[model samples]
Target: MRALTAAAIGLAAALALVLAMTAVGAPSGETSPEPLLTTVPKHP
Candidate 1:
């Protein structure tokens, strides 16, 4: 039972770290453009 609890805690910590990194790398409510999707077949 103790082992299971420790594993759960570790998993939660890892998940939190990943989420924090993602949030910092790409902030919320921000729009990112895709040049490849935008260009092509334009004024052709």
Candidate 2:
């Protein structure tokens, strides 16, 4: 019984976090999905 209650609480918290983020519209000017860097310098 104790384990079940703990699991339910954790699930609720996670759902709340997701909803909050969606409501906030992500962080302002934040890099969406981050950027990938893989460029080589050109030789002169």
Candidate 3:
């Protein structure tokens, strides 16, 4: 039971670390402005 508890805690810590890293390393929406500007039609 103790081992299982430790394993679960470790897994949770690892998942949190991965999520934090991804959130930090991911690109911001402002990085790409062309797509947002060009997606709409120029003419009616």
lDDT of each: 0.85, 0.89, 0.86
TM-score of 3: 0.56
Q: Write the per-residue lDDT of candidate 1 for residues 4-30, one digit (tens) a residue.
A: 999999999999999999888965585
Put down candidate 3 lDDT per residue, 1-44, tens digits, no spaces: 99999999999999999999988897656565555555666786
Q: What is the TM-score of each candidate against the true structure?
A: 0.57, 0.61, 0.56
Q: Which candidate would rank higher by lDDT, 1 or 2?
A: 2
Regions of candidate 1 where Cα sits further than 4 Å from its true position? 26-44
1-44 per-residue lDDT for model 2 (tens digits):
99999999999999999999899885667566966867876889
Candidate 3, run of 10 with poorest lDDT: 29-38
Residue 23 lDDT in candidate 1? 80
Estimate candidate 2's alpha-carbon lDDT, on a 0 to 1 scale. 0.89
Q: Name the regions of candidate 3 deviating beyond 4 angstroms.
A: 26-44
Task: Pick the TM-score winner.
Answer: 2
